[model samples]
Target: MGESIVITSGKGGVGKTTSTANISVALANFGKKVVAVDGDIGLRNLDIILGLENRIVYNLVDVVKKRCRTKQALIRDKKNENLFLLPASQVDDKSAVTPEDMKELCSELKEEFDFVIIDCPAGIEQGFKNALAGADSAIVITTPEVSPVRDADRVIGLLQHHEIPASLILNRLSVQMVERGDMMSREDVEDILAIKILGLVVEDQEIVNAGNLGTPAVLNQNSPAGQAYLRIAQRILGENVEIPSFEEKKGFLARLLGR
Candidate 1:
């Protein structure tokens, strides 16, 4: 059976969707049949990030409403035959689907793929619950900021409430900022969130450019974030890969804060 995983964060713009898209592609590249489900509902962009938006005709809502078959709604990746996308509806409201529906869809998808990754929407609301309901594991993404760390902590607590095993993905870390005592280090983020580090994606403009071009950074081998995401995907597949730190040093302030 396939594994269902949700990439989520309580705060928006913390690289949840990007991580989902990239990791899904990376997993597919590893010869795994992967299906990425956009659980963002009204604000769906997983399709765009995967560069499959233009090919989407039927979405998740269409499948739920029996307007189309699941196979028909799934958009196959142009580059990887094993990678598919189940996009969220643009016209429908967020309340159109429930956690039970997500669970059913995941159960069905599991029979067909090796991995099912859900790109959860921000906040610890219905959308979050729905996205996590069917996930066997979760990737909680955050940034180096204290606010994002706090929000990630809250999300971790909620995931624990649901009895879901979750790992942390610290995104947008700046090595230079950490050296200058301007940003939080990986240890600082893990210390605050109190979760195992899954991976760290350094701040890279290439990720932004890739997003603009409707392609995930993992598809662009030149991006450091892409390499980091590939490692994350390998880790998710139970590979004993070493997680790297994106910061140069922990810094004096970090050490002082720890004391």
Candidate 2:
């Protein structure tokens, strides 16, 4: 059976979905049979991020409603044979499924996959509860900003309350800003969240570019953020890996802005 992990963030727009898509792809590339479950229900975007939206014939709701079997809802990744996605329904409401249903679905998937990664929705609502219910562990994604860090703390507390182990993924960090003390440092984020750091993804334009093309940055070797995500995936697989520091060039824009 595979380990179940939930990629969650209390606050939205913290790259939770992006992390789920890329990490799942990264793991699949390593030959692990990986399945990513979109737990965001009506607001699901994991399918879009994986470029599998058009390929989704059945959704989570369909499986729960007995409209189709679990395998019917599993969409294979076009680029990776080992990767599959269980997309959430865009038309069905979030209340259509419960935590127990998610747990049962994950238990079923675990029998066939090496890893099941759930893309949890934002906030501490029913959606979030359903996502975490089936998770063996969790990856909390957050930006280095104060608000994100604060929200991450809350999420960590909730995870602890549920007796679920969790690690931190600090995303969208600007190394230039950190070097200039203009932004929170990685250490600062760790201290605030008070969790073992899983990895750090630097703010890179390549990530945005890859997303626009519906390709995960992890597939791009030249991308720094992509490399970071790959390392995170390795860590999740119980590899003793070191998180690399991203060195950014302090260009004219920084000096011109007095940063």
Task: Indicate which candidate wins on lDDT.
Answer: 2
lDDT of 1 by residue, 149-245 (tens): 8999999999999999999998999889887778888888877878999998999999989899888898788999999999998898899999874
Candidate 2 colliding pairs, count: 0
Return the TM-score for each candidate structure. Answer: 0.94, 0.94
Root-mean-square deviation per candidate: 3.5, 3.4
Local distance difference test values of all predictions, in order? 0.91, 0.92
The residue-by-residue lDDT of candidate 2 on 1-259, one tens digit each, is: 8999999989999999999999999999999999999999999899889988889899999998889999999999999999999999999878999989999999999999999999999999999999999999999999999888889999999999999999999999988788777899888887777899999999989988987888999999999999999999999888999987654445668767977
Clashes of each: 0, 0
